[model samples]
Structures are given as structure tokens and as C-alpha cells.
Target: MKDIILNFGPPEELETKRILEVRSLSYLERLERLMAIIEVSHTLNTAKIIQTKKR
Candidate 1:
């Protein structure tokens, strides 16, 4: 544990993790928006398929 701290330092690693989390937040939000768009597209496609099948 002491060796690991000497190698990387505890506070530095924590700060790096905090910075990474802050940077990834926007990417996460973009992914969420993409997922929502895909979900809606899938629903529309299913409705179209069902309508064609019924006709």
C-alpha cells in the first residue's frame, strides 16, 4: 500500500478520477440521447411493420 501510494500518490489519483468523471459526463449524456432516439425509432418501425402486416 505504501509502495502504491509512492508510485502514483493517493490525492493525484483521486483528482485524475474526478477530472475523468467530469469529462465523461457529456459523453454519457450524448449516449443517453442516442439511446432514446433509437428507442423511438424502433417503436415507429414496429408500428409500420404491424400496419403493413395487417393490410
Candidate 2:
């Protein structure tokens, strides 16, 4: 079974923690994540455009 960790903190604190975690990643890891984000964004935009044209 996988381990589950829980965090209890304010939004600002959580955001800071997340930022720090991302910063800790290597350049290649960060680039891969950014590319995945861009791919998802492009897919969603294409779907929206197709749906709009079908209306």
C-alpha cells in the first residue's frame, strides 16, 4: 500500500511550501512538468474551439 501524508496549514503557508518543493526539483523535471501543462492547456483549448463550432 502507498503511504499517505497529511498537511494542515494556512493557504499562504501551503503555497509557500509548494513553491519550495517545485524549486527543489531538477531542471529536467521542471521542464517535463511545464511541457505537460502546455499540452493539457492546448488540448482543452482545442476541445473548446470544436465545441463552439458545433453550436
Candidate 3:
């Protein structure tokens, strides 16, 4: 994983900077990031389902 730098700025500026940073990454890096995001989303959804079942 690449080192993350925290940035503080207006939303538009931050989004623009993020887009540029992602564009600079290689295809494999982008795919890895996307997979990580999907995994996190799936994990969160599973947790929510478990909680609902417990209630």
C-alpha cells in the first residue's frame, strides 16, 4: 500500500487532488484499491446483516 498523506482543503480542491493522485497510479494499483473497497463494503454489509438477525 502506498503511504497516505492527509490533506485539508475545500471539498472541490480535495476531490480534484484525489482524482489526480488516483490517475497517477498504475492499473494494478487502482484495481487493488477497488478490490479493497469492495471487501470493506462487503464486510460492513455482513456485519449489518448479523446485527439485524440478532435483533
State each model's C-alpha RMSD to the native.
13.0, 3.1, 1.0
Please list the residue runs of candidate 2 whose C-alpha ends up more than 4 Å from where it truly belongs after superposition.
Answer: 1-8
Worst 10 residues of 1 by lDDT: 1-10
What TM-score do all the candidates reach, one by one?
0.52, 0.79, 0.90
Q: How far off is residue 52 in model 1, in Å?
A: 0.8
Which candidate ranks first by TM-score, i.e. highest?
3
lDDT of 2 by residue, 1-55 (tens): 2285677899999889889978999899889989999999999999999999999
Which candidate gets the maximum lDDT versus the true structure?
Answer: 3
lDDT winner between candidates 1 and 3: 3
Our model 2 lands, by Cα RMSD against the true structure, at 3.1
- CA shift of 32, model 3, Å: 0.1
Task: Give the Å error, residue 55, model 3.
Answer: 1.4
Candidate 1 segments exceeding 4 Å error = 1-25
On TM-score, the stronger of 1 and 3 is 3
Q: Candidate 3 residues 7-53, lDDT tens each?
A: 99999999999999999999999999999999999999999999999
Rank by TM-score, highest first.
Answer: 3, 2, 1
Model 2 misses residue 33 by how many Å?
A: 0.6
Q: Which lDDT values do the candidates have, in the order given?
A: 0.77, 0.90, 0.95
